[model samples]
Target: MVTVSAEESLDHGVPAPMRRGEVFTIHATRDDRSMITHRILPEIAVAQARQLNDAGWQVHISELGGRAFKPSEFYQLLSYKRIG
Candidate 1:
């Protein structure tokens, strides 16, 4: 029989999907000190960004890895429309 510790078991575990309205902070690649906060729009915005084939857009909730989304959190920054 094999035994696994809690830390070992959690090592391969995947994170849960992000929820709506969650805030993701975007950092400028050139300037580490600069960051922009963005709230995740509805699911529809994600779908729409994908349909447009804009894969570079990403939504980062924290300081770590970011998830890709079309018309992503960054998109909101570029758009003049009010986001909820």
Candidate 2:
């Protein structure tokens, strides 16, 4: 399944600390491959996930839980298998 989520920004390939209300980097991953968008607002992340869903990709949004600093909290999880 494909999963969409957000994470803190990276500096030189290292994760940078984020302040509350800061922008996030969106991550969409399936198996070993990943797609990333940097410095995006939460709404844009959701829109992208929705677009993928509309295009017949099963997408899952990460839920708000685990680490209190989770950037994934910005959007709901979308998960799906490809429709035949």
Winner by TM-score? 2
The superposed Cα distance between candidate 2 and the true structure at residue 15, in angstroms, equals: 19
Q: Which portions of model 1 miss their true places by more than 4 Å?
A: 1-16, 31-33, 42-84
lDDT of 1 by residue, 1-84 (tens): 122212211112333223323333332222233334332432333343344334433323331235543233534433443332
| Local error of candidate 2 at residue 35 (angstroms) | 5.2
Least accurate 10 contiguous residues by lDDT in model 2: 75-84
As for candidate 1, its clashing pairs are: 49-70
Error of 1 at 63 (Å): 7.7
RMSD of each: 14.5, 12.1
TM-score of each: 0.25, 0.34
- Candidate 2 segments exceeding 4 Å error: 1-40, 63-84
C-alpha lDDT (0 to 100) for residue 42 of candidate 2: 41
Clashing pairs in 2: 58-80, 59-78, 59-79, 59-80, 60-77, 60-78, 60-79, 61-77, 61-78, 62-77
* Candidate 2 residue-wise lDDT, 1-84, digit = tens: 333345543334322222322343444556666665443344555676567556654444332222222233434322322111
